[model samples]
Target chain A: MPKPSPKRKMVRFRDRAKCRFCRENVTHIDYKDTQTLQKLVTTRGKMLSRKRSGNCAGHQREAARALKRARFLSLMPYIS
Target chain B: MPKLNLSRVYEAMFLVDSGDAASWDDLVKHIANILTRNGAEIVGITRWDERKLAYTVAKRKRGTYVLAFFDLKNGLAVVEIERDCSLSEKVLRTLLLKADHFSVADMRLQLGEDIRQDVAQRLMTERGETAAVVHAVVSKPTHTGGEPVLPEPSGDYEPRHERGRRSERY
Candidate 1:
């Protein structure tokens, strides 16, 4: 992992965004739920990291796995 | 060796090609048979949605999704299931994974709404909408009421040419 530069430190703000799954009280994040997954990814079909998405470390990991599964099945684009 | 006793819940989401078939009942049954034949007890199968993909897959741009939940013993021949799905002509792609959170109640909560949405979508298309409105009209197309009437174009509707006319000048 690369060290955060001084500029990156200045950009840090308290994460106000709530984890979407926690907000929705949803425990199971299915790869087939592209509607929800789309929100977690950019138009280029890249998964947003935990910082930008405001996802907890645990849920973020799960979301990444689910998104990968969705990508593997061609349910989602590798490069939208 | 204790892995032999590990029974796990799995969810499989299949993208099916309906371009040639008039009905999906037989296809769904065939998928269920695949699960049962592989020793996975069926939990529920839900019609997730039908829509065009972001990019072409297998030379097809459109597909219908079937989300199936089942139980499988760990180390079960999941590869065989994968092989069968790949071999089947009706399936475009299949995603299988362990779903520890699925429950019997979800059968109604998920599939029940999915079935209702399917009917509503059919009705909408019958009234001259398109059959592929997976994200159109109602997000959760439940049995709300009588046939939905397409809303009239809002007053804010403006011609595209009009917007560019005043802005095109150098």
Candidate 2:
């Protein structure tokens, strides 16, 4: 693995970009939108943290809730 | 019942046993009634996907999904609805979630954009054909180690007790 980042800003410009939903101006992250949530999950079926998703605190919380809801409903797999 | 709901948008996806009714419409209606009976104003409902489960549920290995968007008049009704869904013989599982501020058009779009049905239908048809092919292959005598071996289906196909009782009846 590469050396840990000394500063989050020093990370790749594309990696620390603005939140996804924020760019679209979405208030409520819809859990029923499986297609969108599927992209946010890892191949191993793990949730990416806000730091990784580059989401603001609010959007991160919404995304977490939506992801958990989708998993409970079997709409999304818990593990790939 | 008292109406306490602020008319929030809610979505539920139910896994219904397709074996109960092969007709898609009948399966959709069967699941919709469970929500409608509890005063849920359905916005849009559509067939989601059909496939075998990772594990059997209620002795059913295969099931299909019905995705529904509705408004709850009473927030507490969700718990009751979930209970009813669990108790229903036709419904294997149900997931209920609060989808606040989702518009009718958004729900309509979801219904239209769900493209799992066509592929699942084709898979279901293929499953039937594969089963027939397997049956034919097993029925025919196959050469094994220079000897023709016949399929011993009767001994393996059913439980011993059930087969014993069935034989007694005959």
Best by TM-score: 1
lDDT of 2 by residue, B1-170 (tens): 75453566687878777766477777668777888898877766776556545346567766666777776768888998999888888877888887554443344445555423443234335334331221100011112222222222221112223335442331
Task: Give the alpha carbon lDDT tens digit for every residue of A1-80 in model 1.
Answer: 99988776545534555676677766656665666677777555666656656678778888898788878767678884
What is the clash tally of candidate 2?
0
Q: What would the per-residue lDDT of candidate 2 be over residues A1-80, giving only the tens digit for each residue?
A: 88767675354233545577788777777665555666665544566555555678998888888888767655566766
In angstroms, give how far residue B78 of model 1 lies from its true place.
1.7
What are the per-residue Cα lDDT tens digits for candidate 1 across B26-47?
A: 8778898888888876666766
Predicted chain B of candidate 1, TM-score versus the true chain B: 0.61
DockQ for candidate 1, C-alpha atoms? 0.12
The true-versus-predicted C-alpha distance at residue A25 of model 1, in Å, is 4.8
Worst 10 residues of 1 chain A by lDDT: A8-17
The TM-score of the first chain in every model comes to 0.76, 0.78
